[model samples]
Target: MCTAYSSDCPPASSALHGGPAAPPAAVAAPVVSLREVSVVRRGRCILAVESFEAQSGEFVVVVGPNGAGKSTLLGVMNGFVRPAFFRPAFFRPGSGGPGNGRAEVLGCDMRSFGGWRVRKRVALVAQMVDVDARLPISVLETVMVGGYGRLGLWRRPGKALRELALSHLERTGIAHLAHRPFGQCSGGERQRAAIARALTQEPDILLLDEPTSALDWHAQRGILALVADIHAERRHTARPLTTVMVTHDLNALYHGGEGEARRTVPDRVVCMAEGRVTWSGPVADALDAERLTALYGTPIDIIRHGPRPVVLF
Candidate 1:
């Protein structure tokens, strides 16, 4: 957590004003910050966040029931969905002036900098997308498209780019399927390919929208493990990647099945409901049965499994 001064503290007087100079406080800026952000569609509000922030290199998992606005929050982070206050008048049709709020991603003001300008630095692996079975695009080719955002329209991908794409495919454990048609791969393989494609972008921020949804239990476990491995691997790099994943699977916060040992977890978890953040804190604190029950509007029981609590609905 970032340290912040209390509102009761007095403002520091400057030396130029004939007062002793106060030492500058050291505070790291958040990679993602939003205040009073809201998304309205067809005269209805879908997401409304009073304030949110994610420090650099932090892994945040968003969990909520269907229609709780979990995916909409991710969309706001990735700049795909502009806030009601930030949308242009033309985009809103009959709406008057822009709404009120602030959205900053990687130091760029989302209101003016625009999503396309920062998209190259932000890679998003959205939910599973069905592909035509006869499409001729190879898995390797599909992954290489991630780099096109940075390449722009004039430059063509060369040998180096192709090699980089292959390296990511290998890292994702899909090297053998590199030459296969993307549409032919299974759900798990396609998710892996999607991740490889996102990695090829060399993103600073990674946004995943239900990468494990619609898959079998085995496939879901594989995808979760893959995500954990990717997060761990990227943490050692000079520029550690910031990851935000949205999932409805509560068990994902732990490593194994119900009775298995829980060894890994994200830095934080944010619970959303009715277009608002109901809770945000460390994994341990956010997993309380009562808290979750209230958020999901359903009975939620937590069973103690050794040192970790497993969710039992």
Candidate 2:
């Protein structure tokens, strides 16, 4: 079992050890790939993506306005929302509706394998929910649910699973709150707990939808820092986790106002608007003032502070 903190696992590449490598390795398929994918809800198409790919160990950020289908894109990657494709009547071998498209996550055909199977390898921390204060589950217990996906319904979580959940709670800086009622925790604390739960899954891919939204400035920064540290830590592992985060706050690309470290800058940015990808490119190229201004339909400016660009409205 390759746990999140396993150190005995082999390195991702021999290049890390400066050893003479074998012949050039074959190009691996993308961890997440979607081609001609479209999502419809209530007789309306919410997301239509021609092509989107996230390479292994890459951090990609999806940004756009409120109705740009950013969350829907993440749903497609995590197998929550099935793509709607058109299939000929003759090709429909079953009672299922006609569909046409492809959505592959972690190399599995989501449509064929089912989202439940794909979710076992993918963890999603969706937007914060308003939990009732009287909910009976503790913070730690809530996180333990993540591991239940792998542990079949008949098997109870053993001591090892408990320890694993504790370690993640500690890693996310919410160990002290482990015993607290999940609903009683502050918004930021709840977000941290949510992240801890996702990490407990030991997933190959992490999907975050507005993890830092609806929080105070302090809590927002804390979540961003935690995410950065988690990503950095996973990079040293045998299988670095691929991340896809959706946020409307452009300033989140950098950390700490103006002159602070740009620890949160993702490897790439995918800008979406009107249910379609408006632009996709490296971080530097995607943060252009003109591009963002046009995307948001609002005047925007960018000013460099040290090595990072700060987005100003």
Give Cα-based local distance difference scores for all models. Answer: 0.80, 0.81
Give each prediction's root-mean-square deviation over alpha carbons: 8.0, 5.9
Whole-model lDDT for model 2 versus the true structure?
0.81
TM-score of each model, in listed order: 0.84, 0.87
| Residue 135's lDDT in candidate 1 | 95
Clashing pairs in 2: 85-99, 85-100, 86-99, 86-100
For 129-237, candidate 1 gives per-residue lDDT tens digits of 7899899999999999999888878999999889999999998899999999999999999999999999999888899999898999988887887777777776755
Instruction: Write model 2 residue lDDT over 1-313, tens digit each, in one string.
Output: 1113222344446434444775554456677888767788999888877678997778888999989999998888787787765443323366465545677887677666455577888999999989999999999999998899899879999888899999999998889998999999999999999999999999989999998889998899888878866876777577888889999878787662222335445888899998888899987688799999999999999998876688999
The 10 consecutive residues of candidate 1 with the worst lDDT sum are: 5-14
lDDT of 1 at 217: 92
Please list the residue runs of candidate 1 whose C-alpha ends up more than 4 Å from where it truly belongs after superposition: 1-25, 86-100, 256-262
Q: For every model in order, what is the number of clashing pairs? A: 1, 4
Location of the lowest summed lDDT over 10 successive residues in candidate 2:
1-10
Using lDDT, give the best candidate's number: 2
